[model samples]
Target: MYMRNRTLLPATPERNFQMTAKERREEIWRLIRSGLGSQDDQARATGFTVSRVCDYRRLWKFILREHPAIADGVTCEEALSLAKEQGVKTKR
Candidate 1:
């Protein structure tokens, strides 16, 4: 039926042109979270280039920096082990 949350990804050039980089990033995140299609398809459907869409995950790098606090007595090894135990699959 082609029905999805229309507001998730902006299709109009006018609206997309008005989006800030942060807004664009959020839209891409929403699109990926919905898992409607491959990144290329999602990008094309959302009026974005495949290259730009493929690089969108760079916007989420901040989460990696949120490693558990060492001052709180959590070592890097301990944090990594905990992350693995929690099923947090990091790609690097």
Candidate 2:
């Protein structure tokens, strides 16, 4: 099969695959809060699909807006627990 030259395609932003789960999550949150890109762009930068990016952004916004005290300190598990207790709507 004839393959096109890979170099001709636009380069993707470098993504850090070595980060721990927490570190990666924090980075995604930072990217979302930084307002440096659109949802799709942020997703691409973080190596996440757009839906996951949107989900994280929504969860972060909810935590900040509704539970400011715990927003910065809460872990993903804790956030999910809080969301469950508060009946926060989620797609999954």
Quick one: best lDDT, which candidate? 2
* Best prediction by TM-score: 2
Q: Which residue runs does candidate 2 get wrong by more than 4 Å?
A: 1-14, 69-78, 89-91
Candidate 2, position 9, lDDT = 20
Model 1 lDDT tens row, 1-92: 12344333345666777887656655666665455666655675556677766554332332245642432444334444555676665333
lDDT of 2 by residue, 8-62 (tens): 2211444446666676666667666555566766665566688988887788788
Q: Can you list the residue pairs that collide in candidate 1?
A: none
Instruction: Give per-model TM-scores.
Output: 0.44, 0.60
**What 10-residue stretch in candidate 2 is worst by lDDT?**
1-10
lDDT of each: 0.52, 0.66
Assess the local accuracy of residue 47 in candidate 2 as a C-alpha lDDT between 0 and 100. 67
